[model samples]
Structures are given as C-alpha cells and as structure tokens.
Target: MEHREPGYVADKAQLLKRLRRAEGQVRGLQRMVEDDVYCIDVLTQVSAATKALETVALQLLDDHLAHCVAEASAEGGPVAEEKLREASAAIARLVRS
Candidate 1:
C-alpha cells in the first residue's frame, strides 16, 4: 500500500492546539475533583471538554471524507470499499461515544 499524508496534515497544528486545550480541560477537571469543587461545576467542565473533543472528531471525519475517502472512491475498487467501511466504523464509534 502507498503511504500518503493524513487528511489532517494540513491542519495538524490547529488540531494539536485543540487537543492541548482539551488536555488542559481534563487536567482542570482533575484539579476540581481533588479540590472538592461543586459537582455541577465539574460536570459543566466535563461537558465543555467533551464538546471540544467532539469538535475535533467532527473536523477529522470531515477531512477524511473529503480527502482519503474521496481519493479511494475515485479509484473504485477494494480499497474504496475498505475506506468506506473504515469510515462507517469510525462514525459508529463516534456516535456511540
């Protein structure tokens, strides 16, 4: 198989930034728990962190659909089928999460 740059390569820096922010949010959540912060406040932070990660996931999915899937689809063979299946599985996982 040919190795290609990932769909997210173009936005790698931005993606990393978002991931770091999410990481910080998680750390904050840990601090909140350790400090015995209010339950609702902790929950709110959890929601924010979840949303941040979701946004990143959605962007990644969009990029994969636009680049990897599109390229594979144009080839129209087993690779295309595999990409589609992989994408479907990813979407299902995201939805379940």
Candidate 2:
C-alpha cells in the first residue's frame, strides 16, 4: 500500500465507538438467544447488527476512495493503479454482500 496522509483520521474515534456499539449489539443478540428470547426479537437484533456493519463498511470504503485513492493517484505510477484496483475489488465484494 502507498503511504499517504490519513484520510479518515478525524473519524477514527467515532468509528471505534460505532464498532463498540456493534460489538455490544452482538453480545446482546447472544444473550437474547441464550435466554431463548422470542424468535423475531433475535432476528431483529441480527438485522440491526448486519445494518450497523454495512454502515461502517460503507464509511470505510468512502474514505478509501476519497483519500487513499486520491493520494495514490497524485503520486502516480503502478502504486496508484494497484490501489485503485484493490479499491474496485473491495467495492465489488461489498456490493455482492
């Protein structure tokens, strides 16, 4: 990977916070399942966790495209092209998911 200035440094803390919340949600879902909570309720928690994960993944993808790709392009050469390719592949995976 090309070394460049951070794109989403400012949002790092917030991202961590969101991840922690997702972790808690996962734990909550586990507890709900263990407690034999209603089936719909457990499914609801699963949906929430999935959505939260998707949200975070989107944010990271956006940052990678905007900051990392931009920086790599500015630097120019094979490295930038590689980064672009990697980002494209990642996006494809995300879309499939």
lDDT of 2 by residue, 1-97 (tens): 6355666776798788889999999999999999999999999999999999998888888888888888889989998899899899999999998
Which 10-residue window in model 2 sums to the lowest lDDT? 1-10
Candidate 2 overall Cα lDDT vs. reference? 0.89
Residue lDDT tens for model 1, 6-81: 9989888999999999999999999999999999999999999999999999999999999999999999999999
Candidate 1 Cα RMSD (Å): 0.6
Error of 1 at 19 (Å): 0.4
Task: Give the winner by TM-score.
Answer: 1
Tell me how far the alpha carbon of residue 97 in candidate 2 is from the true structure, in angstroms, after superposition: 1.9
